[model samples]
Target: MIYRRFGRTEQRISVFSLGSMRLVNVPPAQAQATVEAAVAAGINHIETAQAYGHAESLLGEILQTLPVPRQQLILTTKLTPQPQDQLRESLQGSLTRLRVDYLDQLAFHGINLPEHLQWVLQEGLPVLRQAQKEGWVGHIGFSTHGSLDLILEAIQTGSFDFVNLHYHFFQQRNRSALEAAAQQDMGVFIISPADKGGMLYHPPQRLQEVCQPFSPLEFAYRFLLADPRIHTLSLGITQPQELQTAWAALRDPEGGWGNVLRQVQQRLQEREQEHLGTTRCAQCYACLPCPEGIHIPEVLRLRNLALAHDMTEFGQYRYNMFGQAGHWFPGVTADCCTECGDCLPRCPEQLQIPDLLRETHQLLHRSPIRRLWE
Candidate 1:
């Protein structure tokens, strides 16, 4: 595997770190097999979080069955809420599940407010320090998707050893944050690179063309890691195949990814044009479980993806959504929306819900053939 020095640390980290968040509800065997595939492909960095729901347990089973020694791998996980009891419970539970006694890095997860950083310093620091002192956690860090201002403030404080931020094609505003972390020589991890602010999902064809010459994963990984500030790229690999693909992508030795960076940037610009001043529902899914069984967000997302990416995939997914309505996603019918006022204000964007429903209905019921060419 190709390795890069982890910030100022002597340890070499893989460019692509395996993330286990997508394995939510997956059987332990599947999770374990996924990890084994990644490890076999030379990925030594694995990242996960407590909030990922049963992921730690699934990972724990995988680690126990691994044939390699525990010290050979670098595992990173998170603890949120910062309460002593909750922190302790999370660590112990994670340790028990991973079947390991220690963690390479245990970061305080999802600190958005500046006050939350203070909470970590006051309450969470002691616990993490104790864990480190006792040999339970090797290092401490925090991941934030909050304000860039707060992130820069926390980095300047230098209270933690590592930080994870969202940086990608669509959101390049965190250069200052990366610079701040670099000033202290702390490890910086980038999250959701492909979907930062939902930019990479159904990017314009120009963007797709930029990456068509190479893997979009490569474009993202190379772009984020080119600066010495980034130490790791944690990706949520759902299946074993993705693990293998990432392995080869990161290990490409010429240290180049088909030289598509500039093209991809140009493509991202065109893809960005369509959403310049349009209003959009953030897809928070808070407007869920419609009493009338309207699958509002799913239909909207598929429609958005159709308009954003290739309609072929959207048509295919819609076909499946229709074919397996009661099976794949139970009670998510497009026809079930009753113009009810229930799911309206929950949206932070204040989109016209009834109009959106009309658009979604037409898209879903439209001929699949036309959708493919559109």
Candidate 2:
């Protein structure tokens, strides 16, 4: 496994981290085998959270049977911000489930809003500080799916030792946040690079063709690994086969991957140019600050992806997520566009903003799926 310096934490973390969310519902025996395979493959970091159902408990059972010493493992778990009085009890429950006395890292999980950040500062920080003093917590950090502005706000507070957020090839929205975290010398862990990163696990035929020798999933992994700012990428695994795939991807050297990446990227651009012509949204954010609180740019990007790359399913899934995502994604969908023409003068591409919004609404809106968890 490839290792990188985890910024301020100063630990050599495996570029691939074992994410425990998917293990929550798996049979115990299978979960144990998956964990063993990951550890044997040299994955030193394991990340879980209270929100991931029974993941911590299953991991606790596996930890006891592992051949390696406990000190060699870097364990991280997170808690949502709550009243100060309840913080310790909640953390204790996680500790009990994990069968660990102390956590290498504890994060304020899902700090996706300015209000969430305020709650963490007002009620959660003091409790986490106390835990750090008591040796129950080694470091304090946060994980977010918030807007880039909110994420940068949290990073600028200088209160966190590390950050876990979304940053990948399909979604470069958080690129600036990653740079800001690196400047603070904070460890940057990407949340989900496979499932949420364009669902590369089941790639479309065109994407597979363009990516060439590399599988779509491996291309996504290598794309993120090419950037040094990212410390680790989460491999949310349920089966041992998934772990093996990730291990193989990480073990593949970076020598020729760069050239391959450039070729694939060039091919993607050429495809987009051919299909989308000159009227596609540049995603420059100038058409933002919509009067009706519509996420105009995001909606347009989804539309462009669908039109440019025939990624209709992927686009539809994300477009449907807008209203349901609440503060995490924020803003209504293109249906909220009122055609006031306010965004027209601001758009450098001069594409019909309101018209595009209407087109997006038509192409991407569909019956929403109930999220399994928040």
Candidate 3:
């Protein structure tokens, strides 16, 4: 596997790291085999979280049987920033679950709001600091699904050694945050570059045509890897076979891969121009702070994907996540957009914001049961 300098930590972390969230529901033997396969494939960095159900415990069991020493691997797990009294207990639980004496990295999980950040600074950081002092935590960082402004605020604090956020070809909203993290020399780990990064695992035919020669999933990985600012991309693997495509992408000769990346990007741009015409949303957040608390840009982007790329299924799935995702996705769906026109002037494209929102809602709104299942 390809490795990169993980900023100030200075570890040569694997560019393709294993994310344990998907392992929580898998059979124990399957989970163990998957972890073993990843380790054998040189994925030294493993990320998990206390919030991911039983992922930590399952990974802990597999790690015990690995041939490598515990110190030879980089292990990271997360916990939500909690009340001062509950912090150590939470940390101890994670340690016990992972069967580790210490964590290579411990993040304030899901710092997705201003209040979450405040809690981490006031109640959480102190506990993490004590854990660090005791050598139970090696580095402190945060994982976020917050707005770019909030993420930048968190990084600018200079309180972290690393960060995990979502950034991919389709979801470039966090591009500025990635740049800021690089400027701070903090390790930038991208979350969900595949599934949430446009559902490339089951790419629509149009996207496949645009990303010729490479599967949409491989293209997504290459797109992120091309940016030097990104250190690693999380692969939420449930089976060993999922690792092969990524390994193949990594095996490409550097120069050849660079050429392919450029070609794919050019093709994607051409496709966008052809399919979206002039009425497409640029994904600029200037139209934000929606008076109705609707996430205008995200909902419209989902609309564009459905209309432009004929990715209706993916678009519907994501659009329905609005209310369900809570703070992680934040904001109401397009159905909440009032005809207030407050966002119209802010939009550089001069698109009819409310009308488009209504159209999006009509196309992608799901029943309560369907949303829950998804």
Candidate 4:
């Protein structure tokens, strides 16, 4: 139950924040138990969003029953970027749904595209700032699933008191963004580390073996928390038992994980090198400007993990998200590669780009799972 100061907001948020998106998908009783379990585990920060399908409503019912007082918990919610005039109503709606008069934090949800950021600065911020002045909201921030450039641009704006974005062991692509947030003194909340972080919740045998002395989930948790830039990791819980299970694995009693983290990292690297050889994707993002708009590094990274560590489940899970996730995961799958040889010259490794793209498609492509919203 380690707590970190969430940057400029100065709120001490727990290392793990309870996320409600998955809760809304489960039965109400389970959801209530899960929220109670999270609070019992000392998770003070609870985040929900307007787009999360009655999650706020359920929390409204559950919060009234919790033993803890309302003022003691740090409650947060988000709404999409709205027009200036509609922003107050949107904020009030979330308040009504949560049965709360004020929020500890309010975020402009899903600023994943450049246009979304533009709208937030031009139309949304004024209303949100007013809300803050009016005491309906405390701190202002945003959540993003956009490119590195877009994230960097948003951080440079210096308007946010915190940020909720993706950064984990498997996806260190956003490492620079994490550093930038630290520079701005902004709160850094990591979203979906166990699930989107290579589906470590049900990790492959190779990953399990490589992360010796710690489960994949445990290693992922430790690895992120080791970095002081990260303030909290969002845990999506649908049931009470899920929270218990995860926290049980994450608790380190002896407290000598630094040495273990180093050892396991070496093993993971060696495993990648053993199977991937020299053609392994460096993840440099140098092989960009693919005329076909394929996200080359991500595709090949997934391919490397699947081929090297038997992480086919994780690979397929993300590969299938190609077009369905919209701006959240914006890029076509490698099956759309046109063999133009455009990215080849840009790649420092000079690996067989088109051939690898075809291989990625063959190895990981599958029927798209229904989108989370669906």
Q: Rate the local accuracy (lDDT) of all candidates.
A: 0.68, 0.86, 0.86, 0.88
Instruction: Report how far off residue 138 is in candidate 3 (Å).
Output: 0.5
Model 2 scores a C-alpha lDDT of 0.86
Per-residue lDDT of model 2, residues 121-199, tens digit only: 8789988999999999988899998888889999999999999989878778899998899899999999889887887
Clashing pairs in 2: none
Per-residue alpha-carbon lDDT of candidate 4 for residues 162-229, written as tens digits (9 for 90 to 100): 99989888889999999899999999999988888888879888889898788888888888887889
lDDT of 3 by residue, 83-133 (tens): 789889889998998999999999998889999999988889988899999
Q: Could you tell me every candidate's TM-score relative to the true structure?
A: 0.70, 0.95, 0.96, 0.97
For model 2 the TM-score comes to 0.95
Clashing pairs in 4: none
Top TM-score model: 4
**Residue 350 in candidate 4, Cα distance off native in Å:** 1.2
* lDDT top scorer: 4
Q: Model 4 Cα displacement at 41 (Å)?
A: 1.3
Candidate that beats the other on lDDT, 1 or 4, i.e. the better one: 4
Global Cα lDDT for candidate 1: 0.68
Query: C-alpha displacement of 88 in model 2, angstroms?
Result: 1.1
